[model samples]
Target: VTLPPKIVPRINICSWTYSPPHTHTHTNPLFPSDATLEMSNLYAEQKGKTLNLTEDELLTFYGILLISGYNSVPRRRLLWSDDYDVSNTAVKDAMRRNRFDEIMSSVHLVDNMKMTADPFFKVRPLFKHMDDINKTIPIAEHVAAWCKQFIRGKPIRFGYKIWSLASSSGFVHQMEPYVGSHTHLVETGLGQGPSVILGLAEKAEVPPSAFKFYHGNLFTTLSLVDEMTLRGDGSCGTMRQTQLHNVPFTAPKTFKKTPRGDAEYLVEVEKLIVRWTDNSVVTVVSNMEREFTETEAKRWNKQKRTMDKVRQPKCIQDYNTHMGGVDLHDQFVSRNRVNIRSKKWWWPCFNWALNSKDLLSFQRLVAQTLLLRHGTKPSRQGRRSSMAVAITDATRFDSFNHWPCNTGSRYKRCKNCGGRTSFACGKCDVPLHVECFKKDHTE
Candidate 1:
């Protein structure tokens, strides 16, 4: 896949210093003591509770909470009540004041402010400097290597065998060089240039084998078509001519109109063009060995009292199935995102780290839950249970508790023992006889 040569400019890096607000000399009622004093006292008092936790274990816990969906430390404190003996106000004060070192010290977290020490912490420097052509290949290789190292305990193939790279317009340029040979790249929005494609193939360490490119109809530029035909890349001339004539350079009003069914139209050739119900046309270019195939999707035809078969392009179908992982991840991050609104330029990077932490925690939780439900060890040789079972089990037994009945004059028998009573179990919110309450709770 040879594309035109065009240089994308690299972003210039700048340095900045962060200094705490000038509140050290002033006495604030909310924060009574200095961070160091407060943290020391907190550690002395709560040391017994967290004595069992190692430094790494404590750091992991803090990392999870910091990146958790809870917007503030107070909310996080509520969840950690069972484990940590820290007050909500204390947690809030430490975070709000930006006392990272003090908090770490209090929790006995090692590395002494390692989380906050780096100004460019959690920023992807690769993306920022990718436009520097000289740096692109090295950065991609480094990132791929890092990914291979950081991810452990399971084979990468078990998760995503086919890496699907999809991003908003200009963003894809930075990522193209790293896309694996078997990867499917989906470029959304317009303004895709030939240089991006050629640069990816030329620079990326990943070989150009069975790579598929899925883009919006607008991305199928006239130059791209010319390049394909000129290279004699097995593209049908007539089909190319038809596509050049039929597919508008700009999106049409018709394309903007939403369809009621699976897709408005589907055209399959060496390349596939699918106009989906969402009023978007997707163009896919594939070099896979398999022939282009269409699957039948049945929709209920109320007027005809029958099921109507809808033809869906294999490319579109595959895109729909695999493209959702990224969206799902974004949804998870957005739903439980930390609320950090800062004027500091590095805040975005910091926020990204927090989101990453949340994502890691979410993934771990899901994996653990799945492991428990399946009762299987994490290993390549482990046999999976074929039978489908519920991920969680429902409560099997019921117990009675004592509570005061809200209904003053309403006459009813006790739910537990069938005896009339004015009081109810507040915990269970069930009416109970005084005699039955003792026996129900005891036994």
Candidate 2:
């Protein structure tokens, strides 16, 4: 049951900040007056009555998902020169070709002390300098951990992908005392978010799924759909041809405004999600005047009590400020592409599938597998072991849950021969034998 060291050492940490609240325009969503100073301006352009965030403003939301423990793909990331060099396009290509598991990070657990903690958020950063930092945990430990969840106990294949996402200036290091009885893999992100979920399906047995998102005013929906369709209650040929699946959930027509400049409206929709079954109906529902009452806040607070055991500290001290999880992802982890976009507006409109939140929704909307932890590069034979990994090689029985090689680490991959090749012989009675695998693949 030996496991590999993580590739990224520092625990995945996302950094963030938030807006103090104020009076929201009818078009904007609600937040406490003390939540942020930027709330008013952001609210001014809250374009439709629905869709809380456009793609541009997704970083704020991405911060939220990071705290929720989902490896939502960030639009931007902080990739180190080393990570890019070692993982190289070829290694990633190979890992993707051998995807083994589809699960991302687990949901954030609750704790008893009301501390609102998750494992990575709890560990304090003690390193005075980056070079003298712990290498194995950040680099090999975290990556190896993520890999263990995905590839454990699966046979390798080609054309699979492995991904990591977070929202902080994180770090990874080579394992301590480089030579030891146990080998640890490692990986860490300076800032991480859901960057890893984009290609999960190509390598996963259980790939990501999508949820139908219904946002914006009902009138907006009506107009958009009406513009493309002349008929009622059926798929519009134009929309279908364009691959847009928006269909009516309530009234087929638009909502009319009342004298008060306010109108009662709603938008209903269906999305595709997966659990243990297929194509689950994710009927997302919300209404106007939406606010989290004390009861809902209390519910969240109670869950906070249970998840305290998991929180840890940020790897980078300079980027330590955080306010809820998504806030961190928004400010630090998400990558911002160079833009020649319009600047007529007072501010930058971060619209696109590039922000952490939008990408997160993309992952969930499309059912992308998420990574909870980073990874390790340790192999049973050596680093990045691909021995006996050819098409003809026998499947290994212990790929799924090998013993922690050291430093409380393990490895998993999502690139495998579907779920057909169970690495752990006992988990399911797959015919692949461990001895046969070791004999042929041992380096």
For model 1, residues 133-211, the per-residue Cα lDDT tens digits are 3223221110110011124565543321111122211011123222343222334232333433433434433233223
Root-mean-square deviation per candidate: 19.6, 29.7
Off by over 4 Å in 2: 1-164, 167-198, 201-246, 250-327, 333-443
Best candidate, lDDT: 1
Write candidate 2's Cα lDDT for 1-443 as tens digits.
21221111100122211111122111111122222223323333342222222222222222223322233222211111123222232122212212211111111112223443322221111111211322112221111101112345567432111122221222211111111222111212211111121121111111122211111111112233332122121110011111223332222122111111111212233211100100111111122112211110011225445522221111111112321223333332244322223332211212211222323344333222212112222243223334324322343333553321212212322122322223433332333334433432333
TM-score of 2: 0.15
Global lDDT scores for all candidate models: 0.34, 0.21
Q: Where does the lowest 10-residue lDDT sum fall in candidate 2? A: 272-281
TM-score of each: 0.37, 0.15
